[model samples]
Target: GDDDHEGEFGASSGGAFHEGEVAFDEVAQEADDDRDTISLVVVGHVDAGKSTLNGHLLYALGYVDQKVMHRNERDSKVMGKASFAFAWLMDGNSDERERGVTIDVGVNTFATEHRRIQLLDAPGHKDFVPNMISGAAQADAAVLVIDGSTGEFESGFHAGGQTIEHTVLVRSLGVQQLIVAVNKMDNVGYSQERFDEIKKEVGAFVKRAGYRAEDVSFVPVSGFKGENLLERKEEALNKWYCGPTLVELIDRLHPPVRAVDQSMRMVVGDVFKTQGLGLCVAGKLDAGAVRVGDSLVCRPGDVEAVVRSVDKHGKRRRHARAGDSVTLALNGDREELDNVRVGNVLCCPRNPIPMVCSFLAQILTFDIAVPLTIGFQGVMYWQSVNEPVVLNRLLCLVDKQSGEISRKRPRAIGSSSTAIVQVTCQRAVCLERFADYKQLGRFTLREGGSSVAA
Candidate 1:
């Protein structure tokens, strides 16, 4: 059903709606404070020590005190899994602890002398890859944890390894800067030779994934012993590796810039109702700003609600801007806010975001057994929006890399090939042309429940 229809912005055939200007009141501008924050996601293969490394870093930085450490130690020992003492700080969920693995993204905030960090600790298991994607969508940079134990690096980097998939995914999802932490060097005796070997292999692959060599950095450390995480302690191989600790390297990362003055728009990643607070929606604002008493519209639902309050990093504020992860408490009939669910976008009325049923996109398929063609159906994951979609037409096959159209209508687009195609959904959903907004425009296609394209 490729039916053409007209609505708010007229026919949704061509040209994306360009949100012009917005008049954010002075009070709305008061909470317009800039944050020197780095939204960093921690990712790697299962048991790569992602949670251990992040948990220990927070503890070492005084974010987690001795009392919590003692409690975690006693509880881990009782469970006969003492090594999880550090991981307990992040894996607070009972199921994750029972399974001895991280299944959900754990968010925590900590500050360095130079910058504030919003750390997203993502699960590394293949089963939890979708959860990882959710966390990565909110990050500006990523820290890829790799197990340096004997035979472990190869296992995670080989053909069926999560390392390869994760490396490709983060790069494809717009993470330009990546820190490849060669963790658990203690298991390998902190050998510089091993580190060099890993650096050469991973460095080459990440480069092919569109990351510049300079933007991809390597750090050798032992998350278990907390070595080279803060202050570099003299180790057996200190002579060969004298680079700054992980903390120093992170602090040196380029601070992310914000778009606080553009048209107000924020994607709802989670929704809930509090005891005292009304309906609360949480997500990162891609552009513009919002404040208390500000009127906003939720698209697709088209439900209008006023902003009752803004909470940024646990502090209730009068306003908040782009580049921030905030919770907006709505002031209206409780049903209105309750009706607004995750994947719903809140925007300024003046600059209404385009919500459509179908659109054209440039897709790069993965190495799959089957090729893509007309009538292909898959789940489309755009931010928090996960919906089934159909490939209505194979508009044209394009160059694998350059994206130049090569065929008007190919019988099928093979694996690892690129093409511009038209896709339709059963119901209307929000999507913008990739040319307009990278965050809202980009998405991944999954068929048979596996990621098929990006």
Candidate 2:
């Protein structure tokens, strides 16, 4: 009778389970089957209300409780007025709270009408630019927040001109869909003129960063007052606007699609071992697929191993697909697992290549004071790896809009200059061409102790 019932409706009734259990299992299975999880990172200049926007989105989705909000509001008194309730969600450390800024990346999740979103809130301060780079590297889309009232669209000389620099860096890191949130609208009376000015300046910067105008969305909102974030409010205050709310805009973003037929390549993020699971490597699958019985090689020494088991989000599965965070158990000694650190690529043994040494890279310089020349050392950030490398030669610096060399062997590249350079690393590494694999192609050059561009 159980087999007959299951066959009729495609529902499996595990033996010894009650009717209620069967129904619950069926509903849970359906929810798990939905493949619409999207990853987005919120980034902008410091004090741009990035964390506040994230808090509002979570509250609207019913994920953050009223008690937490109350506690945050009370804690705001101890902190500055600018940080109010936002500090709790973004300030994870005591120093960050005291400084009244976000220093590291904070990850939170919320459910929406069409899909589930994993929001990575990155730091906006200039000193914490490295953290922003790391968070942006893992994001599929990005939301750039700007302060409307402060009118701080461009960075001053003292701030290292970080506004345009950060924009260029985020775009080069492969964030396609960008949503520019002109925050603090309440401070400006939600004026249409102010919004337009910000929109125009940001639009110009986005174009200079090599992104099309159509791919960018501009919205006016106050993260502190929770305006234009989740729900619609019919008030004369913002009568001039009739666009989708921020949450709705986020819901409409399609996840970055990866080519399924590409060669098997997955960047290693972490290596862990469970009491019963032996050795496991955890990271998001960038392209292709991996099965339990598939054999792969970890570079730098040509270590080979066979996949003993695969687990995705705590469920044992036969295989894992692209964009899935998976952990693979191996059939070899766990000691060798340390070699597979973050930034290392896992590929087929027959197609093994050196994971280190020098390579030609197309670069963009965000610093004007420093000259990009031969024998100049700068920090290189690609994928999950960040290391110091030397600029071997100034190959050719070309302007993307005109496709011409602005300078040949130019000694210095001002802010927002694109170039193709030859860099030699102290160690071996792996990188994919920008046209082939955008994820591994671009890199950020940090000189003068700051991130220039990617």
Candidate 3:
């Protein structure tokens, strides 16, 4: 009778209900299929209005709850000035809220007219640079916010500016598309000349970092006023500007496409157990595809297991392709899960490689005050692990911009110096060629509890 609804729905009682159900199902399916999600990370120097920009973007997109805004406004009145309201949306911890700054990476999801965005807001202060690296490693693209009014770009000894260092770091992490937001336009009176100057400097720096100048988009806006972000307004300010708004640019930017390879490889990012799901490992599928019931060898650990299930976004899937953030459940005992923790590789049994104890890496220094020398102890961050490491030897000092070796075994590499060095970690860790896997290859060195660079 239900099947007959398609033939004569106007005749029978069950026919009308069946026809309505089918229509509802089709509409729901279309809605589910229409979604396009892109993951982006927002990063910049401290007090660059990163949190403010994130708040305004969400507010304009109708993603900010009205009650939250009301509470913020009421609190601002009590505090005697308008504090950062959007900071609350990202930094939920009370310590972060009281400090009025972000320390760790904060993730939030928002939907726009064009697509859905999973945004990672990273801390901008120098002290939290490690957290920034962690967030950028998982992002597809980045939004670098700069304060237009201060124009304080160069923090260390480099002539270009700190934004230059930030750009190079983001590029090294494999972020192809970049959106440069020159915030605090209201403080600068929305001057086209100022915006152009910052844009030019930043564009040149981006180019120097091995990124195409055309790949960078510049948007001048006042995050506090919510100007030139999601909506376009015809005003006396910024009359010379004619370009896509921040939200427009974000929607227009496409996700970074991964090149598929037949070789089987996957870098583990984290290991956890979900409710009702035991011993799940999450990470991007770097190459090849894995289906449920396929056998995989946990490299370095030398453990073997059958993929009981592949869960993605709460749905059990038959297989996972490259670039998918998948969770693979094991068909064996849970204790073996520790063997596949972050930094472990997943591959076939025949192609296992040993995790290296020491490696040579080209490193650039961020803090110039402290000279990087041989046997300098600092924290090393790669993938999700941050541990103490010693810089065993400075093989050669290289020029930052030219990429030419300046000296062999220099006594010390100062700020703005790039050098190739042999570094030994406190423990064995997995690392791939930077060209092969940028996510796992790149690392940040920290000294005196401050991040220098990768």
Candidate 4:
């Protein structure tokens, strides 16, 4: 059961609403200039060391103290995977450890002198691409970890590679800064030729995926050995590489500008219940601010909940703003939790997300086995929600290269195609025009266990 108040949170733990509101406003405003938090998501192909790299980073930053590492080492050794000790830091699930693959998103936080990074470790296997997108959508920048081991890079970077899919997906989701970590260099004796070759191949594809070459950086690293992550190695170690370490490149990236002034809107990335706090929703505040006692609406259902409390980066806060990954505790009708799930929107009571049965979206097809035609059925993944949708009409065919309209009404869109179409989901969804909100606007269509369009 929920508390009696319909829209107002009963009382602040800090006492009077006046004092809480004043402190909340100050905290939200300070974030605008502080730039203290930067959300970074790691993406790449499977076996590319994404977990090990992030785990090593957590170690170098002192987040994984020696005692923790020792325990991880003892546990991994007992399981006959002593080498997996570093990776154990992020792959916390037992199933993931047994399969030796990341099955879910791993999230942790680390700090540097300039800013704090909300590190998101996405599973690299194509099977987990949906989970990867969930992680990517909430990121400010990304690091594509490439395998430097022999023949491994080719398989992950060539046609039909996770590299292409990952790069396209992240860019489509609005991540501009990309740091390509050419990891596992020690396996090839740290050869400069190998690093250059991998960099050149990756850079060409990244540029085609809509990222400027200037915004992308490449550095040689060995996550397994803890090289070039936090500090630069000596010439004797990585002789040909004289550039900054992984942390240096990350610290140099400025956090993206936030939509702090827009009406408060946050997509519920996860949901849970607490003993005394009632319902809690965690997500990035896509725009504006939320205080301790604001009224909010959950739609697609138009349910109501009062902001019970706010938390950011594991710290209890009086307020949260755009770009900050926050969790909101809500007290309202208990049944409201039934309608709210991952991918639901929580927004200002008066300006809730518009739920629509159908909408027109300009789409770029990646590699579909067949042409997308009317009445086609597939899953629509957006803002952490994966719901079924049907293509109702092919409004127009677009130029393959230029993206301009080439035909008024094409019958279908094929592999490597572009078109604008009317998409009608099986259920109503909170959606907006792509041009209006890039974060919430883009999505992917998957069918037959493969991504057909993004």
Candidate 5:
């Protein structure tokens, strides 16, 4: 049985086919299109008001009109969920509305004074963590929502909390900038003591999770009452907390440098048929640029397709560059369209991505209950792709400080250890070396439904 599963996804030893350069066409520049864009994902435990906070932010920014809010108020009240009125603005699905829990990634776009923000509202429930991973994979930064009510913060921040898991997940996926929004301060009567307690504890954990003190920021706000979001309207909050509002902090986030020189690559998040567009695939461009009439290919199948049009946040554009969440109108027949699935990578046809079944990875183990050993099976999540994988070999443990081999042929790796190990996937999937591509190479490993390593 062990032999049957070895190299199920890719070869035991191999490298990507070629390191060829792709010819990219110059994109037509649009006038005054200089505003930077940032993809932000809101994450935390269930009922932490992630959706409510973001939903109200959109409304306060005038993205949602009064008529819509009034209707949502009436409808949510009828369903005995008046508190979910703001959340309904983000949670569009009927099931999510009725259940009062976000099940899928709710995406919406808004702009600050200096930035165009594509907000991704991630599900907080543990069952939906995989979905959250999908959202975090696309995000350049994260907004970790924390409940400030008594006992709530402890529950979400302690061992086995989604807060801890989310922090690690986002950081492992290459999200550098973090904004910890201490939501529901109204419950604590806007107490400075409570806010400081949360800040101190969360701040320490964030550092341990690989975030610098400078990159991590904290803000106190009431998601339900809508205070300290756009402005610190509450007199109580102003006495002790004289800091930037949530919107202000968001506007201050640094945009990541785009990889315009690399070949075009985008991982498909969603695929659907449109009336006029024929077929469309939505994703954040990971590298290079794409324009109308550009030829592309989807990996694992190597199916060729053409870009019919490019659109960002529903606005038609002639081209889109790296770090943009865009929908590409693709031209293809029925058979070709059927082959394009989520987790499939789209790149320039001249240089298609490689499919790998096995590769060596440098992973950092968390507080896993069981030690990682040879033949250990777990799910590997890379970008939008999740595959069954086996730890085919134990290479060696490396010292974090010295950058030297700690041990050769380590039989087992425990918690908080760094090791280079060979992993085999159940099937071939497209991935690049982390040294070559930071975003494309990083991944998380989950075992027995818990995130064990990254």
Candidate 6:
């Protein structure tokens, strides 16, 4: 439910609404010149130490204090899970803490020497893969944490495991940079052989998933022992692995090019109400810039709202640009604002994002039980939106090496094939062509609880 409002937000009866109509090109670069901001998603199989690793990183970076750490330890011990103290820092929900598994996306912020990272901690279990896809959609890079203990790595890397699925999903969502963190090395006695074995296997898979060799790096870490995260102190670990620590590796990552000068478009991730700020929405800016007092429209409902305030990483700011994860307090009609939900896009009124029920997409199919033909049905995942969709037409199949059309109007396309397909959604979706907007255009198709294509 939303509150009742009378007039347009930030608008006067005199018809003067020019407060937020400034030229963005002149000031987009100067807005956040202090450092580059990167939205990073942490993903891996269940119990792979994704949360624990990031929890330790936060403590090491001084984001969590001693008092908070002691409280978490006391509470976790009372719950009979003393080992989850660090993980409890990120998994705050009671359901997640009680079950000892992450059920939703855990978000936090930290900074390196030259970059600010907005961390999106995704759930590892199969039931929450939808939440993981939403988190990955907003990220510029990802770190796939793999358990390094003897049989654990094999189980997670083998067929029907979340490791390969997570790897493929992130790459498909346009996450070009990757870091395969080999976690729990201490359980293997900090063995270099074990670390190398994981690196070799994961390296091959990432390559097959379309990640370049230079864009991918491997690091051995002990999330529980807090080794090689911020600093390497163990003699056993330092014996053979002399590469950069996890923090150092993150510091070296290159920020992706953004579309700050383009039209404003931000995909909503979550919506909630604050004590004083009536209705607030959090999301990542896909392109252009947003500022307080700017009038914007939310698609799928044509809800108009004004940016009452802007907060980036919990700090209020006047302006924010593309690649920045922010929460905005929007002022508008209570009934209209109530329609604002996750997967909706907020953009400039001059050019609202296109909302369509169908679009042409180029998808790379994975191993499927049957060939994909016209009327094939599945859920299409785009950003934070997932809708029931059906394949309308099988346009053609393209040859991988030659990038030329191999067949026209094929009867069906099977696994390991590339094809131009027409897809129709159950409802209207805000999107652009892949050539126009990569973040808005790319999507994943999941059928029967498994990712089928992307």
What are the lDDT scores of the predictions, listed in order? 0.80, 0.71, 0.71, 0.82, 0.86, 0.86
For model 5, the stretches where C-alpha displacement exceeds 4 angstroms are 1-32
lDDT of 1 by residue, 193-234 (tens): 999999999999888777888788899988878988896675
Compose the digit string of candidate 6's lDDT tens values, residues 111-184: 99999998999999999999999999999899999999989998888967799999989988888899999999
Model 2 has an lDDT value of 0.71
lDDT of 4 by residue, 217-284 (tens): 99999999888898766454556677888999999987766666666789988899888566899988
- Please, what are the lDDT tens digits per residue for candidate 5 over residues 163-275? 98999889888888999999999999899999998999999999988888999999999999999999888888999999999999999999887666677889998999888
Q: Report the Cα lDDT for residue 293, model 4.
A: 75
Name the lDDT value of residue 19 in candidate 2.
36
What is the lDDT for 203 in model 6? 94
Name the Cα RMSD for model 4. 6.4
Question: How many residue pairs collide in each prediction?
Answer: 0, 5, 0, 0, 3, 0
Over 4 Å off, model 3: 1-38, 65-82, 111-116, 150-165, 257-259, 262-272, 279-281, 296-316, 327-331, 338-354, 364-371, 396-418
Superior candidate under TM-score, 2 versus 3 = 2
Off by over 4 Å in 2: 1-35, 65-83, 151-161, 234-236, 270-281, 300-317, 326-331, 338-340, 350-354, 399-417
Give candidate 6's error at residue 58 in angstroms.
0.5
Model 3 residue 273 lDDT score: 74
TM-scores for all candidates: the values are: 0.90, 0.82, 0.77, 0.90, 0.92, 0.92
